[model samples]
Target: MGRKAKYSYEFKLRCVKQVLNHHQTVEAVSELNGCHHTTLHDWIRFYEKYGKKALLPRKNKVYSLPFKIKVLEAIEEDSLSFSQACLKFNIPTKSVIMNWQKTYKKSGIKGLNNKSRGKPKSMQFKRAKKKSSKPLTREEELLLENESLRAELDLLKKLQALIQEEQSKKRKP
Candidate 1:
């Protein structure tokens, strides 16, 4: 699933129309609509390249590793800009290509593999706490006793500080 679009299709269409049909400057239309000029320019570009359908919200897509490599190769071989590559590949955003390029550069083909989304597989199967059949050894018992003593000491120190703070406040008054 993809995040909901901040701008509605109709709103984008209206902005694009204002620029293309009304012949208004991108900056003027964008400023009037309380959006960035570059954003408006992108809308215009998508509209010109892919028609009205491009303005609609797209579902999250998982590109295969081969397809990812192909897109990267095309960009490098054809010397395509991010925007041009996006338009050619029908990618919704340029950031997708940029991220793919970064991943490819850092880790090669293995990095391009689509990682499983959401909670990891390890988290799904929780390890249940096993009850020990035998009693704790003498050293183990000492360690547990020491931990309890440390906790008790910390609690007493906190209580002492609170009592001191209270006494100081009363003395101040």
Candidate 2:
């Protein structure tokens, strides 16, 4: 639901060119273009490293865990850099390969699995909230009774305080 910032490849190219060809300061160029200097810096880096092709837009691709593992293995075996992998695989961006590398390291093959996005609508199916109508176990009953006693004790404390205040007022009078 949040607004996503989208920039055309041409705009990025122009920004990169301005920095590269015109000798314009990255900070000044980015400020004039209404984009951050770091964004411009990244664009320049990508342009310099991978050329304009790196800035081109591509459709989203969902990679399977097997494919992810394979790519990770290739990267490890070949000692390929993230940029090299992106170049060799024709990946839209280097970040995809970097993310895969991170996932591979953190969770091996399992991390590549696509997790379900967004909050669940219902808690009934959730593992934690599985209350039943069955009679409570002894320990559970004791805990329940202890909670009940604590609530009563709290109420008694408030009443005791009120009684003590009343007695104190009468004694003062």
Candidate 3:
């Protein structure tokens, strides 16, 4: 087995940028970076082809529609198996193709964009919580009730003081 090649994000971006600037062929930059010529060519093609977006790290289980379309197109053209398509595109999952196929079958192209498969019960609970928090836990309820009683008592005490002050003034007069 061959040793794995590694390049930092900055180094790869620099190499790709240099290739796009046309200062040197991809072959030369790949040599300088100790990367495979084909790898550098693909990197340059990807960078030139996709711009800044291509440099972003991909999320698992998320493939762009264009990339999905390309995978499907390749599969259709070459009658490639899932594994073959995965190898061809360096796609992360065979399941991704399967998911796309499932989505396409159900709702066509619009289905390919990000979508929730179904409303989970937990999601419903979360929504409910947002709309109104669950009734406070027993301890919290008791605390709130105690606080409310204290506020009412404070108001009552102030009222009693005002009444006592009025009676005292009338007696003085």
- Top lDDT prediction, candidate number: 1
Report the lDDT tens digits of candidate 2 across residue range 41-79.
777876777788878765566777777777778799999
At residue 89, candidate 3 shows an lDDT of 79
Query: Which pairs, if any, clash in model 3?
Result: none
Better of 2 and 3 by lDDT: 2
Q: Write the per-residue lDDT of candidate 1 for residues 9-110, one digit (tens) a residue.
A: 999999999999999999999999999887788889989989999999888889999899999999999999998888888898889999999999999999
Pick the winner on TM-score between candidates 2 and 3.
2
The TM-scores of all predictions, comma-separated, are 0.69, 0.46, 0.37
- Cα lDDT of model 1 overall? 0.92
Question: Measured by C-alpha RMSD in angstroms, how accurate is candidate 1?
Answer: 7.3
Query: Candidate 1, TM-score vs. the true structure?
Result: 0.69
Query: How do these models rank on TM-score, best leading?
Result: 1, 2, 3
lDDT of 3 by residue, 3-46 (tens): 24355557778888888776888778888878887666656655
Candidate 1: stretches off by over 4 Å? 121-173
Positional deviation of residue 136's Cα in model 1 after best superposition, in angstroms:
27
Greater lDDT among 1 and 3 belongs to: 1
